[model samples]
Target chain A: MTQVVALSGGIGGAKLALGLQHILPPGELTVAVNTGDDFEHLGLSISPDIDTVLYTLAGLANPELSWGRAGDSWNFMAEIERLGGENWYRLGDKDLALHIERTRRLNAGEKLTGITADFARHFGVLGRVVPMSNDLVRTMVITDEGTLDFQHYFVERRCEPVVKGFAYAGAADARLPAQLQEDLQDPSLQAIVICPSNPWLSIAPILEIPAWREALLEVTAPVIAVSPLVNGQAVKGPITKIMSELQLELSSASIARFYEGIIDGFVIDKSEAHVAPEIAVATHVTGTPMKTPVDKQRLAREVLEFARSFGKL
Target chain B: MTQVVALSGGIGGAKLALGLQHILPPGELTVAVNTGDDFEHLGLSISPDIDTVLYTLAGLANPELSWGRAGDSWNFMAEIERLGGENWYRLGDKDLALHIERTRRLNAGEKLTGITADFARHFGVLGRVVPMSNDLVRTMVITDEGTLDFQHYFVERRCEPVVKGFAYAGAADARLPAQLQEDLQDPSLQAIVICPSNPWLSIAPILEIPAWREALLEVTAPVIAVSPLVNGQAVKGPITKIMSELQLELSSASIARFYEGIIDGFVIDKSEAHVAPEIAVATHVTGTPMKTPVDKQRLAREVLEFARSFGKL
Candidate 1:
C-alpha cells in the first residue's frame, strides 16, 4: 500500500481526512495536523485541530456540531458559567477529558506527538495522527481589533474581526516532528494531499515551517491541494470572508495560485471546472461538498485517482 | 446573633458545616477548611474539603454520595478511563467546574482564599467558607505502605493501609488566613465548633498548624468538639480502624481526650454519654447522626445551645 500524508486543520480538513482514512489501507494514511490553534484554557492544553482529526477518524465526532463528541453533555460548561469562568469557548464534558489528559501528560514532560499517538490508538483510529511540530507555534491573527489568539479570534469573537494578516509566533523556533519527516521521506510515499481547509488559517501554518516547505519542494511525490472554495464560497467557516477581507478573488483559480510553485495538481468542484484552464497545475473537477460519509469517500477516491494521473503512483 | 467559626475536613465535616450554616444567621458562621487534602489532579487545583463544604452549605451536594454535586454526570470520568488517564479520583462533570475555575484563578495569581470565597458566593452559600491557609499544606499519611498523600491514602487506596502516623508537609510555613484571624478575634465571637470529622484525617490537618493551636488557647471563646465515633464505630469513614491501628481505644472518650485542653466543651451521641466521666470538659449529649436536612438543623441547634450553656453567649 502506498503511504499518503495529509495536512489538516479543523472541521473542514477533518472531514476529508476521515474520508482518506476510510479509503486507505490500515496505517497507510498519516495526518499532520495544525497545532497553531492550540492554546491553554483553564490550565488545560487544548489542541483543537488534532482533536477534530482524531474524533472524525474514530467516528466519535458530533454529527450536528461538526465538532466535539456525539451525545455530549454540557454539565461542565454550565457550572463553569455559574462560577463566573469564561464560557465563550464551549467545552463538552466528554471532550474535556482529552484536554485534561493532554494537559496532564504535557505538564509531566511528555511530548505532544507521543501523547497524540497514544490518544489516537486509544480512540481506535486506524490512521496515524501527528502534530506538525512539538514546539509551540501559536497562530496570531493580526486583526483590526488588534492581535488576537487563533481561538480567541475564531471561537470567542466569532470571526467578527477584519483580517489584516496572520503571524505564527514561535514558528522561527519550530521544527517538524520526526514522524512527519519520516512519512515525507518514505520510499512508498504516494502524494501529499492538502485537505479542504482554510489555506491561510489552516494549511499556511504547516507550510510556514521553513523545513516543511523545503521538504515538500524536495520530495518526488506530487503535491496536491483540494480547494476549500466551491464556486466562490467556502463549504464552511470563514475562508470566503477572509479572502474578501484580504482583497483576494474567491475562486478555485486563486486557491490553486496560492499553492502555485509547489503543487503539481489541484482538485476543485465540478461546477467551477471552467477555471481549470486559468490554473497552471493539472486540475481535476469533482463533487467536493462532503455532507455525508459516502460523499467524503467519493471525493477522497476522486482526489487520489487524480493524484495517480500524474504517473507518480 | 453570635458569630462562630468551624474547623472542617471533607464529607463528615461538611455535614456538620451544612447544619451550622442552616442554624446560624447569614455572615455569622465562618468555616476554616483544612487544605491538607488538596492536591493537583489532571492539571487542576482540587480543594476537596473546601468544595464539599461549599456544596453542602449551598444545598447542592449529592444526597446519596455525601460528596460532589447533586445530579452530577460521569461523562468526564468515563472518557478519561477510555483514554487510559487516571480515573481513580472520579471527578464528576459538574464538580469539575469548581476545580477548573479554581485552578484558572490560582494560575492567574489570584489567592485561593479569594477564589474559594467567590465560588461560595456564586453558589449562594450564606456562611463564609475559607481555606485554613493560602499556602500548600499537604497531609501525608505515613503508613506501612510508605508515605502516601491524603487523597491517595483515602480515595485511591480506600483507606486500606495500616496507619503509623501523619505529617503536614507544609504546616511549618503555613499561617492562619487573615480572615480566620479576624473571625477569631472578633468581639462578637461566641464559640468555636470543631465539626465531627476524623480527628486523625480531617481536623488534625487544620489543628496541626502551630498558630492554630496557639490562637485557640489564647482566645476567650469556648471551643467545642463533636465526637466522630458512636458505639465504638465511626458513622462514616475509617476513623475507628485508624484509631485501633494507632494503638488508641475506639471510644468517644478517646476523641474527647485527643482534644484535651484545647476544647472547653464536647458533644457526644446520647448513647455514649456515659463516657463523659473520662472527659474533663463539659459534655452535652445529643442525637448527632444527620441523615436529613431536618436532622442537620436539629443537631446544629443542639450544638449551639450546648455552647451557650458555657455562659459565653
Candidate 2:
C-alpha cells in the first residue's frame, strides 16, 4: 500500500511529489498527476503535468526553469519555429522522446497509466507516477475570449484571456485506474496531499470525476492541501491572477474554502497564517516556497507531521 | 519553364539534386523524391527522401554525416533509447520537427505535394521539392529473412538481409499531383535527370507509378541518368551491396540498363567509360563523385549540356 498520495498539476505539484517520494520508502508514494493539461500538438499527445512529476521524481527536473528535464535542449522547438510549425508550446529535444514514446504506446492500445508507470521506471523514479484517469479529461477554460482548450488558453494565449470559469470536458465519464482505486481502499494509505497547483485548472479536473471523487471520499485517510500561494501570491503560475479574475479573495482562507467539503486539513504559508484561524478544519502554517531540496523536504515533513496530528477521517 | 526534373532517393540523389538546384535558375529545377521509403513511425508520417532533398537544397543537409539537417542534435534519439523506444531509425532533433509538422498538416487534410512545396519555400530552397505521388507508396523489400518495410530493411536491419526483390505498395493507384502533371506537360521543359541514387531502391518507386512514368515518357524533353556509381562503386548508400545481393552486374551499364527504354542518355564515371559501349543510348563519361560544390556544379552542367545537344525526341 502506498503511504502517501500527492495529487496536483505540474511544476509546483511535482516539487512536493518529489519531496514526498524522497522522504518515503521506495514505492511508498503515488503521485496522481493531472492529465487535464494533456493535449495533442503537432500530432503528439503531450501530458505536461505527468511529465513534470516523472522528471521531478527521477531527479531530472530542470532546476533553472523549474520545469522540464535538466539540461533539456530546444533544438526541436527551434526547428519547429523555423519550419513555421506550432511554436507556442515549447518542447525540449530530450523531452520530445518521452512524448513520442508515450504517444506511440497509447496508440498501441496501452493505457496512459501503464505508459507513465513504465516511463517512471525507465526514468529511475523512486515512486509511481500515474495519470488521474485513462480517459481524456481536457481542462477547457471558459474565458472572455471564448472557450479554449487548456493548452490553447494557458500556453498559446499566455493566459491573457480573462477567466469566466472552467470545465473538465470528459471528467464525468472518466474512471479511476483500477490499481489506483484498489490503492485508495487500502488501509495502509496514510494521507492524500493535494500539492500547491491551480485549483480550477488542475485539482478540479481530477475531483470532477465522480468515480474518483467518491473513491477518494470513501478512503479513511485524511486529505490535506498545501497552499500554492505565499504572501497571498502564487509561488509560480497564474493562481493569484486567476483568483482575482474569478472575483475571489486573495488569501489562503479563500483557497481553503474552495476545498471546503473535501479536505480534512489545510497548510498555508507563514505570510497567510492569519487566515488559518478563519478555516473550519485543522490548519498549519509554514514557508511553502520550494526553491531548494531542503525547502521541499522541510515542507513535505511539515505536511506529513500535520496530517499525523489528526485521526483518519 | 522548369529546366530540369531529377528523380531519386536520399543522400546520393540529394547531392545531385542540390547541384542542379544551385546551378539552375531558382525554381527551374524540380526534384521528384521517392516516397517509397516513407512510413508511419511513432505515428508521424516520415518522408525520408523528400526531407533529404529539402535539407540538401536548403543548405541544411548535414555536411559531415551527409544526411538529415546540418548541426542536427541527437538528444531526441538518445532519450528515445533511454525510454526503450524504437530508436533504430535515428530521428535527429531538427529533423523531427519536419516529420511532426508534415504529419500534423497531413492529418489536417493537406496533400504531401502542397506540404513539400510549402516546406521548400520555407527552407528558402532554390528548387521545388516534390513527392513522386501524393498517395502513400511504401517500398517493401523482399529479403532472405522475409519481407521488410523500406526503413526496416534499410535502417533497422542495416541492409544485412539479402535482397531478393522490391515492391512499391500503392504505386499503381497513386496519381501525379496536378501541378507536377502540368509541369511535365510544359513544352519548354528541359531534360529529365535520373540522379545517382539506387536504380532499384530510389528511382524504381517513382518509375513504378503508372501516371508519373507515362507523363514522364510522354514529355518532349530528353531523359538522361547520372550514374550513382563511379569506378563501379556507389558514391553513397547501399547500391553496390543491394546490387550484389540481387545478383546484378555492379556497373554503370547495369544501372543504365535498368532504365532501358525510358532513357535517351546515360552518364557513367571515367573509370566505367569502357561499359558505355554496352549501353545503346548516348553515354557521357566524367568524374561523377560529388564531394564539393564545384563537383556538383560541374556534373549538373554536364548533364544539362548533354541534354541540350540532343533534339527533343
Candidate 3:
C-alpha cells in the first residue's frame, strides 16, 4: 500500500525515475515531472521532462541517445534541415509522434495530466507520470546572451551561455494539477523522491510553484533529494558549469543547501560522503551513478531504506 | 518568355504541373494550387495541393505513391498509431518536415505564399508553387453521411460517402496572393492552364474566390482546361464515383460544360474525341493520359500548343 511521488527533469532524472519505477509496484509510484522545460516548438507543446519520464518508464528510451524513442530515425529532422527548417532541436521520426499527439490533444482542450496518463497507459508504463502543473510554467534561463527559453538555452545553444540566473515564468500563477494534489494528500503516501536532475533548471521550477511548494511543505511524507553532482562535477549536463557560473560551491552539499527548507533528507554519492555532515538534514550516502539496471535498483532501495530509518518503519 | 498560371489540386493535377515545369523555363510557370484541400492536421497546417505542386515541380515526388516525398518513411505514422493517436491521415516522416516548417513560420506571422515560395526555392523547384491565397479556404463535402471536411471525406473515408454538394468555406472572402494578382496582370502572360483535377473539389475552390475568378475572367490571356476523364472514367481516384453520385454525366464534355464561361478551350483525351463535339467551347484532341515520362511532357506540349493557337502564337 506504499505510495511515492518522485520529482524529475529529463535525461538524468529519467534514469532515477526508471530505477524507482522498477523498484516500486505498478500504480504505486507517481513521478511528477518538471514542466519548466516545456516549450512551443513548430507549434508543438513539448514537455521535455515529462516525455523523458514517459519514455524511461515505458523502456522506450534510446540507450545511446539518452532521450527520445528507441531506434528512432532522423528522417524527419534531416528533411526539416534540407527544407531550411529549425533543425537545432531535433525531433526524431518516431519521437515526433509523441509531440504531435500531445500538441493535438492539448490544443483540443485536454489537460497535460490526462494526456500524460493516457500516453503512459498506452505504452504500458508502470506507475503514474504527471506534470508538476497543468498551467503553463516555462523556465527562462538568464544568461550572458540575455534570457532564453529552457530548450533554446539547453538544446539550441548546447548550454554554452554562461548562466546568470533563472526565472520560473508563470510558476507563481501555476497551480498544482488536481490529481497531484489528491496524491499529495493521500495518508498512505510514503516519501517524495527528488531525482538527481539539475537543481536550478529542473527541481527549482517545480518548487517555485506556490501551491506545489505549499503542498510539499505541509505534506506529512518525507521529501528526499538526491544530489546531481558526483564529487565537484556533474555526471552529465552543465550542472557543474551552471553552479560555478551562479557563484555557488560545486559540491553535493551546495545542492543539498539549495533544497534546504523543502527537503527532509539529502541523498549523495558515496564519493561525496565527507559532505554528509555538512547537510543539515539526515543524509544517505549511496552509489547514485545509475549506469546499470542493478545500480538504479540498488540506489533506489537504499534511498527508501534511509527514509524508513526516520521512525516510519 | 511565355508566362503561365496553372491551377491545380493534388496527385492528378501535380502531374501536369510537373510537365509544365519541365517544358517551361524556370520561374515561367506559377502553379496556383487549391487551398480547399488544405487543413490543420494535428495542429500543423497541411496544404496538400500546394505540397503536391511543390514536390512535382521539385522532382521529389514518389513515383509509386503518387504523393509524399520520394523514399519517405512511415515511422512517424506508425508511432502515432502505437501511441493511440489519430492515424487516419498519414503524414510520412520526410514529408512531415514541410508541414512542421510551414506551421512554425505561419505561427510566427509568415504568410503561406512566402513560405511556399521559400520552400520551393529550398527544393530547387523549377516553377513557382503558390497556394491559391494566403487566407484559409477549406472544402466542406456535403455527403449523404453529412458534411465532412475534405480530408475526412477523402483520406479518412476514402471518398465512399455519396456526394450531395460542396462548399468552399472562406473562398469568397479569401483574396489572391499579391504575386498571383501581379502575374494575372502581366502583359507577357500567355495562358492559364487548369490541370486535370476534380472540378467540384479542386478547381471550384480556387474559382469560387471572387477576386481570383474576376482576374481570370478579365485577363487578356487564353484559359484552357485539361479534362480529367478518359472516355467516361477518371484516370485515378474517385472522380467518376463523385460525379455519378452528384447526378452528373461521367463525361469530359460535362466537365467542359462546368467550366463554360471561365475556360476558352477544353483539351480532351483522344479516346474522348466522341464527346468533343458535344462541348460548347473549342476543343483539342490529345493524349491526356499522363502515365509515362513522355506522356506528361507530350500532354504538356499539346495543351500549350492548344492555348497558343488562340491568337497568342
Best by TM-score: 1
| C-alpha lDDT of all candidate models, in order | 0.90, 0.88, 0.89
Model 1 C-alpha lDDT versus the unseen true structure: 0.90
Q: Can you tell me which runs of candidate 3 are displaced by over 4 Å?
A: none
Q: lDDT tens digits, residues B108-186, model 2?
A: 9999999999898888998988899898888999999999999999989889999999998999999888877877877
Chain A TM-score, candidate 2? 0.98
Backbone clashes in model 2, listed as residue pairs: none
Q: Quote the TM-score that chain A achieves in each candidate.
A: 0.98, 0.98, 0.98
What 10-residue stretch in candidate 3 chain A is worst by lDDT? A304-313
Candidate order, TM-score descending: 1, 2, 3
Provide interface RMSD per model, one decimal.
0.6, 0.8, 0.9
For model 1 the TM-score comes to: 0.98
Sort every candidate by lDDT, greatest first. Answer: 1, 3, 2
| Candidate 3 backbone collisions, by pair | none
* TM-scores, one per candidate: 0.98, 0.97, 0.96
Q: How big is the positional error of residue B135 in model 1, measured in Å on the Cα after superposition?
A: 1.3
Better of 2 and 3 by TM-score: 2
DockQ of each: 0.90, 0.85, 0.83
Among all windows of 10 consecutive residues in model 2 chain A, the one with the lowest summed lDDT is A60-69
lDDT of 3 by residue, A109-154 (tens): 9999999999999999987999999999989999999999889999
Off by over 4 Å in 2: none
Q: Single out the weakest 10-residue window by summed lDDT for candidate 3 chain B.
A: B304-313
Candidate 3 at B15: error in angstroms? 1.1
